[model samples]
Target: MSEAALPSRPASSLATPLLILGAVLALAPFTSAAVALLGGAAIALVFGNPFQGQTRTWTHRLLPLAVVGLGAGMDLRTVARAGLHGIGITAMSLAVVILLGLWLARVLKVDRDAGLLIAVGTAICGGSAIAAVAPVMRARAHQVSVALATVFLLNAVALILFPPIGHYFHLGQSPFGLWAALAIHDTSSVVGAGLAYGKQALEVATTVKLARALWIVPVTMGIGMIHARNNKEVAADAPPVKKPWFIAGFLAMAALVTWVPALHGAGHLVALAANRALVLTLFLIGAGLSREAIRTVGIRPFLQGLILWLIVASLGLTLVKTGILTVG
Candidate 1:
């Protein structure tokens, strides 16, 4: 069954190498961020779009594994610590990010949804949040993909610069978790920062990040309702996706740790592995974005992203210090 022996294959085959590259990249320190920042260099050197084609399509399957594994880290107790504050924390964080983002975009005179795309991308899970919101808001493919690249570029920058900044201030886990949850743009960088400091920190940091993730539900629902009323969206785009069952699985994973207690050892390890895998998924998404398309989004999108990012960074600490939010 040697592939070389088969009838000459199409030039369109890249499935094997991309997966292997993703796995290998996961092991490198801040690999996700490094790949994202430098992935373009690889792409340029190769003179091909590894970001596209059959290999890229298959990468989506690996995504669920990483997300579900992330669930293994969260638990009932983590949620309990934040309480109504969980929703408030996410709400407060999102509110600040969106408001500030809009202001920057207005100043820059960028497109509205494009600005919001930057807001969500920077505020939540970077591209994942932007992708989630894009359909709900009915943003154009150009704007949305551009937003993704904008977020990816900043993510790489954060990886290079934030860790040293976190160190410079002598931040510890509780504060560090808040800094990460609010400040860092994606779970990969947050986890990288949290883990580099210590595993215990990553556990708390991831939980905080998950609490932030809870914002996606209400945020999407609110945006969907508004768009539906506005008639801005095409009929085909807004079809309801029953909240994925994995959310239940995520909640269940968290509960198993809190209530069962017996699963802690195994659960902890699984969660840690999941955090690592999630990092790879982010880079994979980053790689899929085209270089020119990425640049078309431009420096303004990043400025908008940065505005939201800085607000979160500041307010995250304020809320944590003032006792508005607390963590395990």
Candidate 2:
């Protein structure tokens, strides 16, 4: 059997204890999202993650639930309004980033599938987007891995830097949230940065990012159709596209809270618990950022991802700061 088929075991005697300690720190009430990520990364880099498979599985399961839980604290009207307002900008940005990323990939001589995966990840929802599109494009394993690693590295940086940058620029809560939602590659990082900023920012960022994530469906379908048209084998062999059901769950939670004023007190508690879960989810994400993953992100692909990200982030910031992008 392959290593994946084997049961999870600690890499070393210290791995379990260290992981336990990291989990405790991540869930601690005072721990910030950035700090949780840093701590987990530190442990993974130093001792390695023995439970890599388990970590990936849990992170996948927990992140969506946490996002759904956060919805309990949101008003449906606000979420709807933010989603509507962001759709146009999100679509435009996605198109620009996808085109720019592809051009940069060609200029850098990166692998076509890898370049496309990186571009899709950057344009949409990071690893989730990459994961959604990869099989349809018949992306190689290394291509998907490199794309994920590049996006993960940038996500770590964005989570840490965005809050300080927002404060430095004296950005309003909603503006900062809008910028984070637009610029950050992953929903986790966007929510983390928004959380670090303030309540209003968190609400705005989460709502807008979730809204932006909805594009994954159409984009994946479009890519699949294009690939199928060029190569019939692609349509025949491609795996079914997975829907982001968490978004609907999130909306349901928001609606429940919105319609029932009596649930507000309980919703607040659930939201708080969800926030803690998100921090832990980040810790798991960081722990998966092993040194091997970093080394796998070779120079050219990393450069392509980095350049594309910088362009998106800078443009997003300028628009938000100049009042060209605002979230109600």
Candidate 3:
């Protein structure tokens, strides 16, 4: 939808649209993000920005809470196995994507900060990775916003494309899960793709993606240290970011599910709640993907992200096809 057609509305008038959005999210959990994305854009086209006051609350606060909530349904043993199995692929893909993205950014004459954000987002978890590293890199607000937009755009595409591609290849749950985990940037897309594939795919993808996300702390700290040594002026200006404590919540929840025998009977209920929470999270993510955010993203950053993702996706599929990156 075009931006010009959207008219600004007061907060009071948003009640109807918000209720409509909630109902849609509940009814169509699987396609909530895609729906919210198109529906949000349409909302913008018709009613102006639908996320003025609540965007931050939804994206920053609610989303992570939902992810942590998901952990309750996961077992520590299964998560460990998934993490160990995915290490080789995750490490290899991350290194290759970062190096390739850096070279591509230089070739395309993109800004280094924006390039790094895109590379990190492509290599690890999408917006979360970028958000964690941005403060350490002292990235400008516009750069962070643009990089996030770029990742979100690709995530939307992945949600639609990866499932069909996996099915066309007749990939088993294990390989398809690995493919989705490695190729998709964000947890939402990974989960979305996996859900479209099968139940087993969702289980495997969730564990692998969460394991991959743990790299954010070390990666951000290492980058910060490098910047400090090479460019003291930039390092001095960089803001310190708190370590992501949400990860601990996720791990702890998994441990609880695994070790606490008493909670075993509650598995179904926890899983149901978690799935609903994820639907809500995706809906919020889509609603926050405003046209203004997309407008801030430059052509070069978007190109860099697309190219990096293509390279990673190709390499991941090849490894799976070759048995080099087999799923347990």
Candidate 4:
């Protein structure tokens, strides 16, 4: 169904107010990350998101800041250790997910760009990966939207389901964090699930996910060069690669805390505040999931994403459980 078919009055009148309320609650100490996401989603589905554009813009801006801020509480040593430890698995998983995703897209007869975007998103860091690769592939707006919506929908599910599943299986904090980092789509969702699981999980997941996210640079550049080779005109007009600079910001913050022991207390406070901002970020992300976005996802793209995600998640879980993917 087209967006025009949806009722407009509630979106025009109530959406802003509901969105504001949800954002306020998300920042409040009483609400958890999952609750904030659910509340924002409920508001959007019921009233539609009048501020959908604004919400997306804010989410993009705030998430990085929150991630960097959380880095203040981390030890540089731990960050380095986690990143280094996960390198082998991260490389292997990215290769597997990308190849498997492309195969699925071709078999499913899904649009090539959309399928590739979904695969890249799942294989790397969800929306960030898609955002980087979309410009390289020169995907159409609708194709990008379909891929993003599929990933977004799955992110919400992973955030809610992962903690419970971790508990059911009695997964340890480090293992669960590693699993969440490898399995979940978005960094925000990975961090949210980690937070829900435990402190150690949050730390491990954030470090590993950010390390995984760095793959976007090489991957996007590779795709851009390939696309350029295939189409000279498109190559001439290809956009410059957008690096994930926030990762550097995060590392800087971690280094600052690690080198200057005097800032430890202050850094802890900053990290705590950043965690709250992350919850607020998730709420805004949820608010962007309007009915129209859901409608735009369609079925085939969603199926491809779902199948790819399941395969990755299952394999990651097995590897982590078997101690093959442990963070040393």
Candidate with top TM-score is 4
Local lDDT at 187 for model 3: 83
Q: Per model, state how many residue pairs clash.
A: 1, 0, 0, 0
Question: Model 1: how large is the Cα RMSD against the reference?
Answer: 6.5
Q: What would the per-residue lDDT of candidate 4 be over residues 1-328, giving only the tens digit for each residue?
A: 3333444434757778888888988988878889988888988888888777688889989999999999998999988887787576678878888999999999999999889999999999999898889887887667778898999999999999999999988899999998999999899999999998999999999988998898999888888888888783443333345567889999999999999999999999999999999999999998888777788888999999999999999888898888887888
What are the runs in model 1 whose C-alpha is more than 4 Å off? 1-22, 25-47, 51-59, 73-75, 86-90, 233-247, 282-286, 314-328
Residues 172-217, model 2: lDDT tens digits: 9999999998899999999999999999999999998898889999
Q: What is the per-residue lDDT of model 1 for residues 190-227, given as tens digits with 9 covering 90 to 100?
A: 65566555655666676676566666777777887887
Where model 2 places Cα greater than 4 Å from the true spot, the runs are 1-12, 232-241
Q: What TM-score would each prediction reach against the true structure?
A: 0.77, 0.94, 0.87, 0.94
**Colliding pairs, model 1:** 75-254
Q: lDDT of each structure? A: 0.63, 0.88, 0.75, 0.88
lDDT of 4 at 86: 52
Answer with 2 or 3, whichever has the higher TM-score: 2
306 in model 1: Cα distance from truth in Å?
2.7
lDDT of 2 at 283: 95
